[model samples]
Target: MGVIMEMNFNEDDKYLLAKKKVEKIKGFYGNLTSFILVNIILIFINLYTSPNHLWFYWPLMWWGFGVVIHGLKVFEVFPSFGKDWEEKKIKELMEKEKNNKNKWQ
Candidate 1:
């Protein structure tokens, strides 16, 4: 009936959304697991060669910040700029293009 994509969520869509959320959380867990595993290996490697210089901590801290943010996003601890924002932006662009087209014609 309408040309524009529907912005509403039906009951079926909720299941898809929940599945996507679970996937995100599962991905974060995988990321965290890799982080821990690799860091443990690096820690031993660092100690084996140069016990004084601890370079592994450098990546540990920086990448750990990224992991934290990823977790926050997955858990929705931080609000996302979501579908509403995307839809509004799309509408704005379409209006701009329409106005430009009108001018050309």
Candidate 2:
């Protein structure tokens, strides 16, 4: 059996919190860069190998489909994490942390 405990956060509660936020941003930036890189590589390969007049069109079609998927993630259409929501959440978290530290000290 595992023991669970809840601890209080103090003014020095900076390490984990800061690390988590940095990790989150790192993850998003990594995903965005990787996504763009992969699509660009695919587009370049298709463009270079295209032999027919409409061969370049094939990559465009495939890229269009990828764009739709990326758009959904960016806009958060279904997961409900649109731009405003994300911004508000970040602001709220910062305020909450500030409040907590003030109260603790």
Question: Residue 97: error of model 2 in Å?
Answer: 26
Specify the highest-lDDT model's number: 1
lDDT of 2 by residue, 1-105 (tens): 122223456766767756765675566566667667876776677767763433545655676676666657654576657645665666677777777788889
Q: How close is candidate 1 to the true structure, as a TM-score?
A: 0.69
- Steric collisions counted per model: 0, 0
Off by over 4 Å in 2: 1-8, 12-14, 51-105
lDDT of 1 by residue, 16-70 (tens): 9889878998999999999999888888999999999989898789889989988
Model 1 collision count:
0
Distance from true position, residue 93, model 1, in Å?
Answer: 7.7
TM-scores for all candidates: the values are 0.69, 0.40
Query: Where does model 1 exceed 4 Å of error?
Result: 1-8, 80-105
